[model samples]
Target: MALPLSVLLVSLLLLIAVPDIYATFHHGVHHAVGSRAHHRIVLPKHHRPKFKPGPWKQAHATFYEGGPGSFGGACGYDDVVREGYGLDSTAAVSNVLFNNGQACGACYEIKCINSPQFCKRGQQSLFVTATNQCPPNYYQSSDNGGWCNEPREHFDLAEPAFLKIAEYRGGIVPVQYRRVPCKKQGGIRFTITGNPYFNQVAVWNVGGAGDVVSLQVKGNKKLKWTPMKRSWGQKWETNAMLVGESLTFRVRASDGRYSTSWHIAPKNWQFGQTFEGKNFK
Candidate 1:
């Protein structure tokens, strides 16, 4: 049966209107769901700030005679060799500050502030280097409580350095110290030690922003560079003897500075020999 024209037109209009109405409803629902999802997201909180290294710090200092025949210390360098190399009045710092030889070769300036009488007539401060570790368990026999066993920031100074700032009678003194850049006049010095079977190289006379951090060695015949391990103190060592006729060293300081010493050690280099290499500063 054929429907009337008016009824057919009305039916068509209703169909179009129904689709428009459904689209409007869907649009509204989509916006509502999107708004709710946006609200559910959370923002993270800010993190804590990092610590800044200070110029000056307070610490306890004690004087001790390294004594005769006292050579290498916990950092592993011979004290006699260190002194001969012009590192006068070296100090042994606590494990807290030593950082397990990471702080080796670092320099510090100390001033005695607690006792005025112990201070020298005109001397107000003394500068020392970190060459050894003051073990916490090790106690000084002379003093009942050792400086090493003291607080974290304790400094065990050699007798000479201690006397410069304080009198010998004052076994312990409160001091204010600061980390300072080492002032070296000449280029870096390389001290070679160990037996013929092994090669141990100690970097000394380093003058720059920070102490030595990494070392690499290359021989004349070797195509690739070999990284050296930090044996102790400022010393870097390799168990096997260098193969090539000439040896070169690449040194990297803690401050991220690098220096290469080309052929510093000769083929016939003997043990206990010292060589001066290019400067880092």
Candidate 2:
């Protein structure tokens, strides 16, 4: 019984010593010193190499897909866009984002490349529902908005690429527009796009968000749209006065992403005096 107990004790001791022995032999900590092992899987920094011309199509390339107002975060044409937003390993942001491990790369997925488009006239916004007809020979991703979501794993710069094309048409393109009904709360009842890709639209030259007494529109084949107006790429410039004094007029453009203030200015005007009717005694 004593011999068996001795064997059991020695086996337990060897098991405990194996890890230290390995560390001592390989880690240069000196076997007699019995120090901890160096244990970490060192990974090389992540990087994107510059591409050659042939495979470079998607390199700085972007494309569009999907119908009007049907963006489902799946990278499509009707998606929101901004220029100079992508991972360019040759650029500073990419270099910094990688070396420092910033979450900027994680916060917002590159929806789609803002590519270019060819509209004969500048793009226009509309009211009372206007359809954005894609140019001929151009087709959006017919199949999207499902589990095959927009590719966000990479630098998707398609929407901006599309906008660049439209910009080449001069000014900006109006994807969709809605009336912002002026309410007592001072916010206009503006239209929002059904597409998640596009996030905003705009309207200008109107009274208080609440002061908008009414709105109407007449459409033309030439433009996006305007309220009580009949043309695309054009707007109704009207004046609004508070109490017949202190006036202001503003202009705006909307494309479904958000409304933008084109311009604004105050006019010199005055309110008339109020009169109180009374009978003399």
Candidate 3:
């Protein structure tokens, strides 16, 4: 039997309301059908985030376009980007020491910078002997990735080597040398502690790098480091040299096999003292 007038009126209102509510549903179903027929895009499981083109020519870019999100690459997500800073597996300069003690991903993400992706080529990272602290003149080692000098480090602080005025008139008398008060270039000085040859006060490395050691007097022009006296490590003591501000500096001790810090500044800057047994390393 045909519906009554009132029933028919209600049915018409329901039909009108259904179209508006199901419009999006119908559209989505048709779109899916068309996409499948044309093989334009796969289903949800296979769908990928639309990737932008790479080779981003922007200033200080972070993420590159058209790169995979979950692939292990050397250049893109290495320790530099994920841990420190630098290009993707791009050959990192061994001399510059970057800050790594901070939090990771706390800064920019990989692909954000035009870093290497380690896809075509593998990764290259340093194996610093210790943490990330670097030395003077030299920053990071080119190979091992720790404290290193500019070239093949040729330095040492041996006796008979002159400081302010080389020639000493009196016996192993008391002398004075200033402390490296600056932050960038620090210095160390000390009195001749051991006379290896009985003629020259000699200091050698039994570990770390080979005979790559050099010494110098500390001053503003000499080297710079933490200016605070407490940071100097030890209270710089004087053996023959009496009074304050005396130090003996040694650095760049590398033997090619086990290269490491020749000597670390003691608790306080002191002369006539020697640091041994893998202290620097």
List residue ranges in candidate 2 displaced over 4 A.
1-134, 138-227, 237-264, 268-281
Tens digits of lDDT, candidate 1, 84-192: 4333457888888888687877778898885777666677578887777878866464245655654558888878788888888888888899887777667788888
Quantify all predictions' global Cα lDDT against the true fold.
0.73, 0.24, 0.26
- Count of backbone collisions in candidate 2: 49
Residue 126 lDDT, candidate 2, scale 0-100 = 13
Q: Write the per-residue lDDT of candidate 2 for residues 1-281, one digit (tens) a residue.
A: 35798899999999999998887677664543443222222322332222111111121212344433332121111311211123221011112121221111111112122333443234332111111111221133412222112331122223433443244333323221112322122322222222222222222212221112122321222222333321121112222112212222222212111122221111222122111111001
In model 3, the Cα lDDT at residue 281 comes to 27
lDDT of 2 at 244: 17
**Candidate order by decreasing lDDT:** 1, 3, 2
Error of 1 at 143 (Å): 12
Candidate number with greatest TM-score: 1
Tell me which residue pairs clash in candidate 1. 71-79
Q: lDDT winner among the candidates?
A: 1
- Candidates in order, TM-scores: namely 0.70, 0.17, 0.18
Worst 10 residues of 2 by lDDT: 272-281
Residue-level lDDT of model 3, residues 1-281, one tens digit each, is 98899999999999999998799799999988988877754444333332222232221111121222221121122122222222322111112211221111111111112222311123221111111112334355533333134432211111112111122231121222211111111122222332322212222212222122232323223333312111111122122222133332433222222212323434354435533323222
